[model samples]
Target: MTQAAADPRYGAAPPPRRRWRLSWNDPRTRNLAVQAAAIAVVAAAVWYLAGNAGRNLAARHIATGFAFLHRVAGIPIAEQPIPYDPATSTFARALLEGVLNTLKVSLAGIVLATILGTFVGIARLAPNWLLSRLAAVYVEVLRDIPLLLQLLFWYTLLQTLPAPRQAVHLGPAFLSNRGLRLPGLVWQPAHSWAALAALAGVVLSVLWARRARARQDATGVRPPVWPVAVALIIGLPVAVWAVLGAPLGFDVPVRKGFGFAGGVTVSPEYAALLAGLVIYTAAYVAEIVRSGIEAVPRGQWEAAGALGLRRGAILRMIVLPQALRVIIPPMTSEYLNLTKNSSLAVAIGYQDIVSIASTTLNQTGQAIEGIAIIMAVYLVISLTISLFMNWYNARVALVER
Candidate 1:
């Protein structure tokens, strides 16, 4: 700098580099300051609104807080996964029952929708033109129809079915206006113990799989996982059942007068809701799956095929795994949407959380608390789903060696 500046050959030395300062003139500083101000404004607005609500509630002599949760709830819920007596149960218990009911439908819908959607998505790209077209039509029709309308249609269709005595028989199951009656287990303590063992076996199988996968990465050869998984998950459960004196009783349904008795009853309300949610959500999920599969380069398929791999093998072994990285994020949203969409159960007289809360608020006139409970329930559910899906997504993400 000294020689060049003195000689005027390199012009003046460049100005000293400026150190960033937290001033209004600096863009980064100004942006942060603006964000802080916006956040403060939002906080202030929330505070004012909350204070006003409290004052209004107080002025009206309306009691607040969650004390009403302990009060008896007289709302009759048709489908309860847990024991719930409307006459004796508190609002808290009733609401808990509602939560369980919502979860029942939501969990089932997610599983069924995933399965159906994946198949339809694959069918969309099938070599058979008719199958592809049919799949396309199915996706288009389902996506275009409003979910609420579909729910209503399913409900109406179920209601029009023949009565209990004239139920359409399908093997051990029967469908009628009352509900679908299916064979069920005469559950026992032994069965419960076996189920617990099976769950433990599943956890152990997952651990074993991880170990096997790690071993495969370190060594070229991988150990078979299925045999060990089966031994743990199935054999362990059977052993537990046998040790506990295996009880294999079945609760077969029998026509008892006007209605069926024994076994399990899939109420029309639940069936309609479950069917509608799965079918409608599957269309969106199908599109997502198709896009994800398509995202896998054609070269991948060609490479796998060139190695003498069948189309199914290429898809299951290679393409599907790669496609998962693309599929999981949007798939998470579909799951959330299905869960949230279940709130619509109230429209068809299905006693989900929203329905129970609405009834509780109406009878008790504790609208704020009731609504808060619903918001909290959904918030918890959405967060849990998001967290699980994000974890899965990370696991499937590409890793560079």
Candidate 2:
């Protein structure tokens, strides 16, 4: 054989690379192509809807732009967080006031409901026959009734009260068909400094709490931090006020002429809305809390008891820590429900975001803009609450190494 054959080397060539194909032959590329197609379809549908809306709007001669938001609202609003005169203020300001009103009631309702629910939930588990029965009745009654009926009932009840001249007075608070008037703070120059001092005290209290928790983790000894926190929060603020000559003052609502003149007024509509939201929401929260508490095994409680821990301590330390892991997810849903239910304020004329936005839509004939604004406001609020709860859930969740 020749030298090439003796070396076992022959003419060799690499196979020609196949032309790249863009189909499911490659799983990844196919998946990406499918997703791209889906996105394109969605985008096209949105564009079509937009164009159709514009044409219909033009045919109807209804103005579609948000420029109308700058024009005078020309509609009366009975309740507002900030002073708003429709004759004087722009529609934008009116809408903003509505958003603020919605937020005010929502935040207040959450706090009150939470506190009320916690008590009712604990009462459900109470050994005393009367307490548990009462709790059960409350939960069943409130939960079974329609929230709309509750709202209307409360509104009717508030409207039946006597007028401002014959207002029911209780200490610094007054109630009447006109509204519930509460003594409001009359801010003095020193109050600003006092507020700052109070804020500082809260920061210090949080820091001290973390330190105490860390110390307990290391040494198995937990110092009571609640007393110190209370002192720092309440006592420090009081001390600051005293140092500044206690310039604390109040604007007490007094019967003046035909109506109360001084103090913060919670309109009857607002009062009913808040009361209804709190009561309706608390029932569900109570159930969630009770279920969370019960989720903890009996063995855990018995073990804690055997270890010489008081019932209260066991409930607080061992049971709650475990129960919270179950509670937070459902509790978050209840909060969201309360927020959405606040929209029912419109039915009773409470002037929430949805109510005001509906008025704006009618007056301006800008349905799209008004609806969009309402949706955006609610989305932002719901997301904020969800994010905070999610972060807290993550912190409390069991961490397995």
Candidate 3:
């Protein structure tokens, strides 16, 4: 400043030119250079590996394309949701079936684990000593043991049950060494129309809810919507079912062959995987829930109590709302973990995506493609879950503004 003010010739300072060589002293330049170099190395490594793989495949006379997907799978799938015959089906179709099986277990496991975990979490905080201790014991015992062992144990236990002829029966349901068979709903073509009607009802209900919310916001009065909700959700569906000739039929399991047939057949392998995933995930979720509940300040509970609110009312109106803000974030992570862990079903012969894809890889000798397919599927699934959870977290987050 002194030099610029003193001399008219040097009235303004010149901007410093960037150096041609990256200076270690300049943090921005150094970081950029290091990142660029690292990226270049990684890119080179990937290109080299791909080239090597191509040469190896050519040398071995092995095909390296997804064209095999259209070829006959010639592999029987037992847990298929839809009809498939190994004699006529393609490998791509089988792979799709494997994906469905994975989703089927993962989605159901998520719901069941959440419910059971919530119960255990509440029990852990119970006023009664016995209940809390029991919940603590359960969490400690189940989470500590290896998950694979749990799957194996449940699978073996199911296998030790009586045969189909001597099954444990409760009305239409039957349990045996093979699996548990229950009443299954057979969806006919007419049911498609019924489903569309139900979907329409759902859309209408959502629109109605928005209008109701707007009305309440303006008037500070909430209308009773239970009757409308019930009629739209339940009555509309039932009316559609009846109008569509009641196309739904139940297939009740009966002792027919060595194993029960002609009903919703839950194989032992599937049951074991489901049970293990649910139990293991529930323990982790329970701890998360307990911690979330504890994170809520005690003063809030006391204030609600002093207002003469009943126990259940205090919990529903004050405690739970605050607790849920904390609970949801960790709960989302647990759900993602449970879904990823479904791959472990292969150990129990559950024929999830990993299992079927691995078998296909071994038989077809397309190791790279098989692994790529698995990785792509998992990547897509994880990304989808992450995006959805983030959106929901934003919705429930506290607004400081």
Candidate 4:
């Protein structure tokens, strides 16, 4: 054989390289082209609509910016988380109060709903026939009913309660048509310091718990967390309070003539809204929890039991950790739903962001700006919840080594 043919480096001329060509047939190229076109169309539409709205508002002698937010808002809000004088407060402050009120209801609803729903979910799987049946009925009925109707029903029901003079007494709390009046703390500087200390303790306890878990994973023995947690979380706060003279004053409610004074007053509108949202949202959360628990294999339960583990211990240690991976994603959605559903407070007279925004627009005639504020507030809230939940989901997700 010739010298050139004998060597692989001198093999027949290499096949010509195929020139790159874009085509609709290529999935990646097609997808990018389609996405770009769609984005451009959306951008153009938004720009044109905004310009048209501005021009029309100008022609009709209406204002178009957020300048109205600084103007005096004489809107009387019944429930203000912070001090607000309608005559003196600006529209921005009023809106901020609205935001706080919304957060109060939404956060409380999420917490209460989670606790109640988890119990209901467990009850649905109980051995007792009656308890399981009752739980099932609750989930089915609540899920089927319209949330608006429930809100209306609860509001009407609360309206029928006896007046403050004839309020039902339960310990330091009173229930009346006015609303629930609960004993409150006469807050002071010492309490504030103690609260800060308690918060700091919580952060420290969480860090310790994480470190303990890591130690347990590396070694065989797990360190006790409760003792340290209690000392930091409870003892630290108590010590702080003691150092500041231990001001433990209570603001007890007392009836004057028609209404009560001196205690924390929960308005009827807030009571109705919270009752409606918590009860309605809990039903769905129950179903999600139930499904997550059932997703654990029967064999895992049997194996744990065979190893002489109690049912509760098996659940707490072995099953729940796995079940959480399934539970968190759906739970995040429920939280978001509860937050958004709070907008319905407008119907019940609760001065949430949406309700306050509507009143603000009517008074100031900044229709676009008011609506934009409401939209922006909810968008930010939703995104924040999503990001936190996503981060937590990633933390609890299964990892294979």
TM-score of each: 0.90, 0.89, 0.90, 0.90
Q: Where is model 4 more than 4 Å wrong at Cα?
A: 1-35, 214-219
Off by over 4 Å in 3: 1-31
Which residues of candidate 1, in runs, are more than 4 Å off?
A: 1-35, 170-172, 214-221
- Angstrom error at residue 244, model 4: 1.4
C-alpha lDDT values of all predictions: 0.94, 0.91, 0.88, 0.93
Model 4: lDDT equals 0.93
RMSD of each: 5.4, 8.6, 5.8, 5.9
Summarize candidate 3's per-residue lDDT along 1-401 as a digit string, tens digits.
68768897677567777665667888778889899999999999999999999999999999899988998999888899767889999888888888889889989999999999988998999899999999999999999999889999999988999988999997899988888899998878677777787788888788788888888999988776667777787788789889878776898887886777778888999999999999999999899889988998999889999999987787778887888889998888898998899999888889888988998898788999999999988888778888988898888788886
- Which residue window of length 10 is worst by lDDT in model 2? 5-14
- Candidate 4 lDDT over residue span 1-401, tens digit each: 58879899879698886554598787777899999999999999999999999999999999778888888899998999999999999999999999999999999999999999988988898789999999999999999999999999999999999998999998989999999999999999999999999999999999999999999999978999999999999999999999999988899999887788879988889989999999999999999989988999989999999999998899889888888899999999999999999999999899999999999999888899999999999999999999999999999999976
Q: In model 4, which residue pairs have backbone atoms overlapping below 3 Å? A: none
Which has the better lDDT: candidate 2, or candidate 4?
Answer: 4
Q: Give the backbone clash total of model 1.
A: 0
Sort by lDDT, best first. 1, 4, 2, 3
